[model samples]
Target: MALYRGTGSGRLSRGLLLLLWVTLGSKLCPTGAIVQGANTSLAVPQNWTAHESATPDNKSQLPQFTLDDHYWLFAHFCWINFTIWMNNVTGAQLCDWRIISRPYSYLQYCLESAAEKLKFGYPNRIADDYIFKSHYIYFLNCTQDHPVLLDPPEDMLLALIIAPICLIPFLVTLVVCKSKDGKTQS
Candidate 1:
């Protein structure tokens, strides 16, 4: 019976790990929408616009544009970076921008903020569209402004490939920790 219990426990752990992996992976994995560009420009939703700013500098400055909604903003940044990479710009050149300074810092901040605001519905889906449009415009403008400097030697796809692989172990650790604590001690 002890041997059977051990085997069952091992299987349970493996199953939990698998479940953790799938959930974490889905949550962490960039959604397909991350690649999709919005066709229309975003306008603050009706009534919601009253709280929004004509121009928002920082998250706090805007009344309607809560710090929570910044995820869309960060997504905009990633979309911009991804577009730049697709155009063949080097990560270093992209990083040269003060905004993109710390690796994934902008995205992390946006996600954290967005998570908080998810309940309010203040970050309407239109925000996503707005981000895409802005990114597309910025990308075109940058290329036009600096044709020579914009040309990158490295493959953007290669860099994207490396990102998730690097993240997997950290995710695994998180899952292990969660699993260990999830069960009650006798």
Candidate 2:
């Protein structure tokens, strides 16, 4: 009876630990950063409707860009490109076009320029600044006055990677704890 009780407790503890691992792992996973690029059928936001209406040809209006939004956009691009390079997706093409390619062109120069103009990192401990406006190209130097633009927060990528790693130790600890309980019961 005592052995059975110990085994049951061990199993319960292991199950609980697994649950905790999954919960923590999920919290760390990249949730919002992933985007489906081919989904042009997505509903346009209301703010975009005003710009669309103003541009009769649909070519004159600049695409509205936000720093956080662009960061995720670039992150998605990087993810897609990495996947393509790994041959996970079929018909993925890697090309080098100057400043007008689909994703790269939109992010590389234009956004940086706008950030500089807006003084995104000026007069502050601006660790980094990234701009993603559609039609501007800018770059700001890293200084006490100028904010850094290239580096993003640790959470941006670390959470996506580290959270999973952290789970491994957590799982191992739980398993060891459970197994010890089982052996002691026998």
| Predictions in order: lDDT | 0.43, 0.37
Q: Number of clashing pairs, model 2?
A: 7
Q: Please provide, for model 1 over 9-48, each residue's C-alpha lDDT reduced to its tens digit, 9 standing for 90 to 100.
A: 5734643453344323323222222222323333222222
lDDT tens digits, residue span 102-158, model 2: 444433443444346554532222112222211122112112446557866778878
Candidate 2, residue 102: lDDT = 47
Summing lDDT over every window of 10 consecutive residues in candidate 2, give the lowest-scoring window: 133-142
Question: What are the runs in model 1 whose C-alpha is more than 4 Å off?
Answer: 1-42, 48-108, 120-124, 142-186
What is the number of backbone collisions in each predicted candidate, taken in the order shown? Answer: 2, 7
